[model samples]
Target: MIHDTNDAIPHQLIHDALERVISSREIVNSDRKKRFLQFIVKETLAGNADRIKAYTIAIDVFNRDSSFDPISDPVVRIEAGRLRRCLEHYYLAEGAADRLQIIIPKGSYVPQFVMREVAAPTLLRALDDDKQSTSERLPEIVPAEAEFSQAPVAATSSYQPPGTAPSRVPLLKRPRLLAGLCSLLAILTIALAGTTLFQRYQVSVSSRAVPSQVPTLMVLPFENDSSDPAQNMFAKGVTEEVIGALILFKNILVLGADTSFQFRTETALRDAVPNVPIDYVLKGSIDRTEGQIQVNAALLRAADHQYLWSGSFRKDFTSKSMLDLRRDIATQVALILVQPHGVIDKAELQNTVGRPSESLTSYECVLRTREYWRQPNAEMHKQVRTCLERAVRIDPDYADAWAALAFIYTDEARIDFNPSAERPDPTLTALEIARRAVALAPDSPLPLQALGIAHWLRREPALSIAAYEQARVLNPHDSDILADLGRAYSLTGDWEKGIPLIREAFDRNPAQPTWYRLFIALYHYVNGQYAEALAQAQKIGTPNLVYTHVVLAMIYGQTGDRDNADYEVDEILRLYPNFGDKAVFEFERRNIDPAIISRMLDGLRKAGLDMDPDREVANEKD
Candidate 1:
């Protein structure tokens, strides 16, 4: 082993060290690794660092075809990583006396040759930076400090021979003092050890215990590693793609870009996020060359800063390749989080397919519009419409955007009923857009689902059933598609078949939103399971909420529980006093089956629902 010295290392020494590593047994053992090492080093020394990229490495070193895709064929990256480990092994055992050290940091392909002492300092600083950054970012918990305030216990021994006599020695002698000091030192070390362990035990329990509910996540804005500011849009697009794909995780709640993008910096993120319990943080940087890109990401537990996963991906920089990158990364992150806990409930794990984006702007708009899903404000709804509208304007062939826009309009009709008679009907507009979506993407299942919704909303039950049945063939396990299909069957008065499919949807998605439980309640009501229907309806939150009260009132009324039904009506009236004068009854009459409408109206009438008394009487006559 070489000792530390103050003399400057020569340039020749670095080259010699590199040569030794490239020719060492570790490198020579693998044919692919030796060539990869030689190529990058030669490129770096020749001042062609920019050319030493994923595409170049794949073609020149690995003999890939001209149409080689760096995303699909990761041979170059795999070889580069292998070369790094080989160099580390060679230096540690065989080249220990070498004055210079060689290394390759992630996110770049250029080899770095430096004096041994200089390399040690940089690595030490990185460790220090990690420690400092961890404390600065996670404010709730910190490393325990060793306390030396308490005095150590005095030395004591219990041993005496039966025939032995005590020596005539004076107290506080030099020898006795030395023994006491040693004993006190040992006691102090043990005390510090125990204290630190106890503190770690407390932190471990608090931070590592997984909660009973589904995990929540927030995808923060990714940092751009490129020097050009123009690449910012690409970085943002990558972040959006990741969030969009992660939406398929039915058991996870992902925060939208609006809130996540607000915390652009680490300081802002840490300061703004402590109140909300986030289970993990997925963050990384994106670097791009002329025809290649590299992404480095780490998934860390928020509570204890434990790394669940960390990896780097280098790929060709086409938009389609980027889509593949996002899908792969999102799938890996979701599965890693769920695999250990045995919580993979949805069909997303089996469906890893993704379509290429014709226009990134349209794709970003589609991703941004999803943020307004749970939000009920008109302003948010307007934002969704504007984004999707502009998306289709920019890319007319964008099928997903058209389909999503269709769904938005259908929702506007269902949830945000307009009172102004002069405005165009939302259901009609949705039907037009849904038809356009189906025409554009005939092979895709999403447009078909949207078509089903539009047809059902337009009061064409048979057409809705046809569209839904086609969609079911394409994606049998999609919960949304199944739910829509079940609703169509209910409208057509096929309660037996519809009820099972809807129940299957709920079974496949244990952590679905509150509205899903309401759908189950509706299905159970149609199936004549009044008690189960009431129980499902009660799970929809406080009965004071309009939807919850409406579901409960109908269930209670049908079971001949008049007192409970009236109580639910009182809550509904308190929540929305104009229920009789509003569109709620109209929504039911238009969407429900004719055979079930009379029975439902009878229950509502007995519960004192004062909505359209004449219409109620007429329904009974039918």
Candidate 2:
């Protein structure tokens, strides 16, 4: 017999059961019984003995919390249930012939060892009867020791009373137990408080992780400080030139003109600089007289909004020193921005100038090209090509100008605009120009990015991906590089890997193009998630997403919604009249669904537009 005597309760129960079962010697090594014993011991030591019978205890432990509620919290009820099955299994296999019996009676928590002479046949019959009745009486409680000796053969044998509780066990009195628990709780409380305070201090220190490299600066649109309104363009030109010069240095993330212009109308300095969460902002005002220009510039630390550096420059336009003065101002600003790292010497600053002239012609050309590219029509494409061509001519070795020219041609081929005006083979031309730019300066990632796009357009996806990966390694924080990488991956049908890269790029520059949304939509469409594709397409505003109409028409057609499909098809035709069978052939070559083709043709037919419906049927036949 085993009694609950704190620590001994666990050992005594197992020791007594093992001894009795071994004495029977019917089956010497029972793996199941050994496993049950080990399970009970492990549970008790783990402070989960009360939940021993619950099947979900292991799962609850794995979840690492008490989020689940069990029906019974009684330790006795749980142990009794487990013990009955354990003893039954042991008796049937290991204790068939033993006169001395071990009984873990139904619905009783503790084990009982009954020493009685009993025939094997009668005991087997009694065990069979108990098995039949036990399952139905799962909630029933049996009389403690009375049921143990009440077997038919046990009536003839002498019964021994249960043993007294063991003396070696120490009693944990209620008052002492409560006091120990309170002390433990208090210790945990103090430890947790100290740990939390330490963590908070670590976080505060880490929030300002010392920038890994030189701190960057964004020379925001300078205020026109001149009294004459006509001089405003000259002031703007000076600010733009400064931005252009600073961008040549590989160390800086000069917020481009597109981004800086967003802040032009923002009355407050804080509102204008939204996307760039930087450490500093360079604010300046340029005032000009008939023959002289005065520029006042101040660099303010973004963290505390305090001024870190300030200076003023005066130059006469007619004097030969004017160009020298502009270069001096640029050199000084670059030095101040990079000062936290180290002071840049005059010789090093002079070396940064790849082109010595302070002429605004190339700068103005870049600005015009930017505007034209934004419009992205046939005429705009031609204008951009012309501007970029002129820029390259002005500075023969300008890698940026070459890259811009390559990008214009790449865009023409990518969007299926007129390509002959730019080059007979725009994609190949773009690739050659991009490769030349990279050959000239392999460290620059911009040319490599353009090279990647050319490879993508050439249908060499794997090579494109490799080139983009190389670009990312060179400039990890470049948003344009990230976006191009995402597009390359998406085009190659690796949507899962592509979406996150695009998302990171979007987080870096939200106002760039809506290509991220378009890529996501295409991924969904190809994967047979039509509704999701439509939803993502809608998030990209309609005016900006011209290709969305084509995708929407395809999605609606495939889903068996003819009316909506025809509506989208009509809209596409209205917007782009030249969209014809070549477009359909391109769609088919890209593995667009046949049902979508039928819907597009149907919409075009209903809109009274002339199209060769036979072309789709012939492609299918071929």
Highest-TM-score candidate? 1
Worst 10 residues of 2 by lDDT: 152-161
Cα RMSD of all models vs. native, in order, equals 27.7, 32.3
**Scored by CA lDDT, what does every candidate get?**
0.58, 0.52
Error of 1 at 399 (Å): 1.7
Candidate 2: segments with Cα more than 4 A from true spot: 1-360, 363-375, 542-546, 559-563, 575-580, 584-622
Residue runs of model 1 more than 4 Å from their true location after superposition: 1-379, 417-423, 526-528, 541-545, 558-567, 574-578, 581-589, 616-622
Error in Å for residue 253 of model 1: 21
User: Candidate 2: global Cα-lDDT?
Assistant: 0.52
Q: What TM-score, over all chains together, does every model reach? A: 0.42, 0.41
Q: Judged by lDDT, which candidate is best?
A: 1
Error of 2 at 140 (Å): 97
